[model samples]
Target chain A: MDTLNLEGTEDTPKVILDKENGIFELSGRSLPEDSAEFFQPVLDWIEEYSNDPNSETVFEVKLEYFNTASSKLILDILSDLAEIEGTTIVWYFHEDDEDMEEAGEEFSELVELPFEFKTY
Target chain B: MQTQDLILIYEGEFTQDITKAVLSMAERNMDSSGEESSVKRKVFNVMVECLQNISKHAESFDEKSKAKNNAIFMIGKQEKEYFITSGNIVRKDSVDSLKNKLDKINSLDKSGLKELYKEIIKAGKLSEKGGAGLGLVDMARKSGNKLKFDFEPVNQKFSFFSLQTTIHRS
Candidate 1:
C-alpha cells in the first residue's frame, strides 16, 4: 500500500492518507478548480486499500469549509470506505457546529458500515 | 428597483477572486446591520455555490477570447430582502441535464426533496460532469422558495445559465 499526499490549496483541502498505518485525513476547505480531477486519485487510493483489507481506518476531517462539489467527493469517499471489510469510520466536527453534525449524520445514514460521529 | 441599498457588480477574470471579495465584504460589514449573521452567511454561501457551479461546469464563453475564465456576479438588496444573481456560459449538452435536475428539484415537496437528496446521496451516482446535484436542493430549502433559472442560447452548442436566489432579513 502506498501513501497519499495532496498539498492543500486556497479553495481545496489537503488530503493525506497513509496506507501503511490506516490513518486517512481530509483537512481544510474544498472548492476545487475541478472536482473530478482532484478527487479521482483519492478514489483510486481507496479502491486499492479496499482490497488490502484493514481492521480499522480512522478518518480525520477538519475542513474549515467545503463547497457543494467537494461535498459529493467526500460522500463518495465515505461510501467507498463503507464497502470494504473490517473497516471502521469516525468523523469529528466542531462542538458548536450543528450544521456540520447534521451533515455528518446525513452521510452516516446512507453508509452501511460502522461509523462513529464525534464532537470536539 | 434600486432604492437605498448598496449595489454590487463583479466582472472579473477569475471566480475565486470575486467570491473572496464578496465573502470578505460580508464578513467585515455584516455587523453594521441588526440581521442575524447566520442569515447573512447563508445568503453568501448560496452565491458562492452558484459561482462554483459556473467556474466548474460552465462552457467556455469564447474560443479566441483570452478572458474565458471571466464571469459576472451581481448582488443587491430591496425591501428587506437580498437578491443575488450570477451568470456564465455553458455547453448545450449541460443545459438539459441542469434543467432536468432543477425541474425535478422544483417538483419536490420539502420532505420529498429531502428524500430525493438522500437517494441521490446513497445511490452514489455522480453528475456526468462531477456535480452532486445537492447545491440547488440545499439552496431551495434554505431560501424557502422555488429556485428561478434561465437559459439563453449563445449558439447551437453553447448557452448561458443564469440563476437568481433571495433570502429575507431575519
Candidate 2:
C-alpha cells in the first residue's frame, strides 16, 4: 500500500500510515468542521491495510485537542485497528493534561488493543 | 456592549476562519492571564466546541430577521473563573431538542457525564453535519460545572438560543 502522509494544520492532525514500515501515527489537533469528510480517507487506508495485515503494527496518537466530531472518527479508527492481530497503540499526552490522559483511558477502555500511555 | 473583563466578543457570521481567529485570540488572552496550563487548555477546548456549535447549528437569517448568519460569542473573566458564552438564532422546531439536551447534560454529575460521553462515542452516531453530538457532553465534562442555557422565542419560525460554560482557574 502507498504511504499516507498528511501535514498537520491548526485545526487538523498529521496522519502518517506506512503499511510497509508497520508504522501508523496521528498527531496534533483535530477539530475539522466536517470530520467525516476529513477522516474518510484515513479510514479507507486503514481498512485496506487490514486486509493484508502487517506482522507488527504500531499506531501512535498524539493529539493536543479534538472536537467531539473528531473524537468519534478517532474511535472508529482505533476500533478498526483492534480487529487486526499484533497491533499496539501508543497514546501521548502533555504532563499536566489530565483531560488528555483521561481521554486515552476512555479510548483504551472502549477498544480491545494494547495501549501504552506516555506523557511529555 | 463591551465590559471591563470581556476578553473577546464576536458578532455576525461564524465561519471556519472566524473560529480560528477566536481560538487564537482566546489562547493569547488566556496566556497573558498567568493561569495554569491546564486551566488554559480547558478554556481553549471549551471555546472551540462552543464556536463550532454556533457554526454548525446556528440558523442563518431569513428574510424575516434580515440578519445573515447571525450569532454572538463572548468570553469574560470574573474572579477565579472564565465565562464562555455563545448565542445564535436557531430554527423554532429545534428549540425543544436543544433544551432537552442541555438539561440532560446539566443534570449529570462528573462521573455520570464521563459515562455518558463514553457511551455516546461508542454508539458511533454522527449528525447530518458529521458531528458526534458530543459537544454538549464535552463542555459539561470539561467545565466541571453545570452547562447553562436559555432559549427565547423569535417570531414564530426562530428562537434565539444561548449557552454558557465556565472554566475555573484553580
Candidate 3:
C-alpha cells in the first residue's frame, strides 16, 4: 500500500501510515469540526492495510489533545488494528497529563492488543 | 456586570479561528496565574469541550434577541477552583434531550462516567455534526464534578441553554 501522509492543522492531527516500513503514526492534537469526515480516509487506509497483514506493525500515537469525537474515531482505529497480528501500539502522554494517561489505560483495557505507554 | 473573579469572557460567533484564539488566550492566562501543568491541562480540556459544544449546538436566535449564531463563554476563578461557563441558543425541541443528557452525566461518579465514555465511544454513533456525544461525559470525567446547567425558554421556537463545569486545582 502507498504511504498515507496528512499534515496536521489547528484542529486536526498528523498521520503517516507507511505499509512497507511498518510504521504508522498519529501525532499532534485532533479536534476537527467534522471528525468522521476527517478520519474516514485514515480508517479506509487502515482497513486496506489489514488485508495485506504487515509482518510487524508499530503504531505510534502521540496526541496532545483530542475532542470526544476524535476519541471515538481513535478507538475505532485501535479496534481495527487489534484484529491483525504482530501489532504494537505505542501510546504517548505528557509527564504531567493525567487525563491522557488515563485515556491510554482505558483504551488498553478495551482492546486486546500490546500497548506500551511512554511519557515525554 | 462582570464579577471580580472573571478571567475571560467571549461572546461572538464560534468559528475555528475563534476557538484557537480562545484557547491561546486561556493558556496564557493560566500560565500567568502560576497554575501547575496538570491543573492547566484540565482547564484547557474542559474549555475545549465546552466551546466545541457551543459551536456544534448553537442556533441563530430570533431577530428580537439580536444575537445571530452568537454564544457566550466565560471563565471565572474562585479560591482554588476554575469555573467555565457557556451559553447558547438551541432549538426548543432539543432542550429536553439536552437536559436529560446533562442530568444523566451529572449523576455518575468517576468510574460510572468512565464506563459511559467507553460505552459511547465503542458504540461509534456520531451526531449529525460528527460528534460522539461524549462531550458531556468528558466534561464530567475531567472536572471530577457534576455539570451544572439550565435551559431558559427564549421563545416558542428557541431556548437559551447554559452549562457550567468546575475544575479544582490540586
Candidate 4:
C-alpha cells in the first residue's frame, strides 16, 4: 500500500506507517478530543496493510502520554497488527515514565503480539 | 511548612480547545514546580481524564436551557501532594450509574484497581461518545488514590456532579 504520515500536534501523535520502507511507528503524545475520528484513517491503513504485510513487521510505539480514549484506539491498532504473522511490537518509554511502561505491559497482556520493552 | 497553592482554575464550557489549554497550563505548572517526571505524568494523565469526563456530560446541557451548561476544573498543590478536581452538570438519570462506577473504583485496592482496569480495557465497549469507560479506573490507578465525588440535585431532571482526584508528590 501507500505510506501514511501525519505530523504530531499538541493533542495528537506523529504517525509514520510505510509498508514499503517497513516502518510502522507512532510517537509523541496522543490526547485527541475525538480519538476514534483521529485514528480512523490509521486503522484503515493498518487493515489494508495486514493483507500485504512485510515478513518481519515491527511496530514501535513511543508515546509519552495518551488519554484513555486514545488507549482504546491503540488497542484496536495493535489487534489488527496481531493478525499478521511474524509481527512484534517495540514499546518505548522514558526512564522516569512508569505509567507509560505499565501501559505497554497492559497492552501486551491484552494483545497476543510479542512486545520488546525499551527505556529511553 | 504546610502550604496550599492554587495552580490553575477554569470555569466555563468545556471544549476541545479548552481541554488542550487546560492540560498545557497544568503541565507548565508542574514543570515550573520541578516536580519529578513520574509525578508530573500522573498529574497530567489525571487532569486529562477529569477534563474529558466533563466534556462527556453532554446531557447536562440543552439548547433550550442555557443555565446549566458550564463546568469547573481546578488544580491545587499542597505540601505533600497535588489535587485535581472537576465539577459538571449531569442528568439525574445518570447519577446512579456514575455513583456506582465511582464507588466501585474507590472500593478497590491498588492491585484490584489494576485488575479491573485490565479487565475493562480488554472487554469494555466504547460508548457513542468514544469513551472506553476506562477513564475513572485509569485515574484511580494512576493517582493511587480513592476517587471522591458528590452529587447535588438541581431541579428535577439534572444534578451537579463533582469529582476530586489526588496524586502524591513522592
Each model's total of backbone clashes? 1, 0, 0, 0
The whole-model lDDT of each prediction reads: 0.74, 0.89, 0.89, 0.89
B63-147 per-residue lDDT for model 4 (tens digits): 4766434799999999889989988888889899989999999999988998998888778767898888999999999999898
lDDT of 2 by residue, B19-79 (tens): 9999998888778877789998899889988898888888874766655566999999987
Candidate 2's residue-wise lDDT over A37-109, tens digit each?
A: 9999999998898899878888999999998899999999999999989999999999999999999999999
Clash pairs, candidate 2, are: none
- Ranked by DockQ from best down, the candidates are 2, 4, 3, 1
lDDT of 4: 0.89
Question: Please, what are the lDDT tens digits per residue for candidate 3 over residues B7-71?
Answer: 89999989767888898898999899898898888898999888888888799885666555689
In model 4, the runs with Cα more than 4 Å from the true position are B58-69
lDDT of 1 at A30: 80
Chain A TM-scores of each predicted structure, in the order given, are 0.90, 0.97, 0.97, 0.98
Each candidate's DockQ: 0.39, 0.88, 0.78, 0.83
- TM-score of chain B, per candidate? 0.85, 0.92, 0.93, 0.93
Using DockQ as the measure, name the better of candidate 2 and candidate 4: 2
Give the runs in model 1 whose Cα sits over 4 Å from its true position.
A19-22, B1-4, B12-37, B57-64, B77-81, B89-100, B122-129, B150-161
**lDDT score of residue A83 within candidate 3:** 92
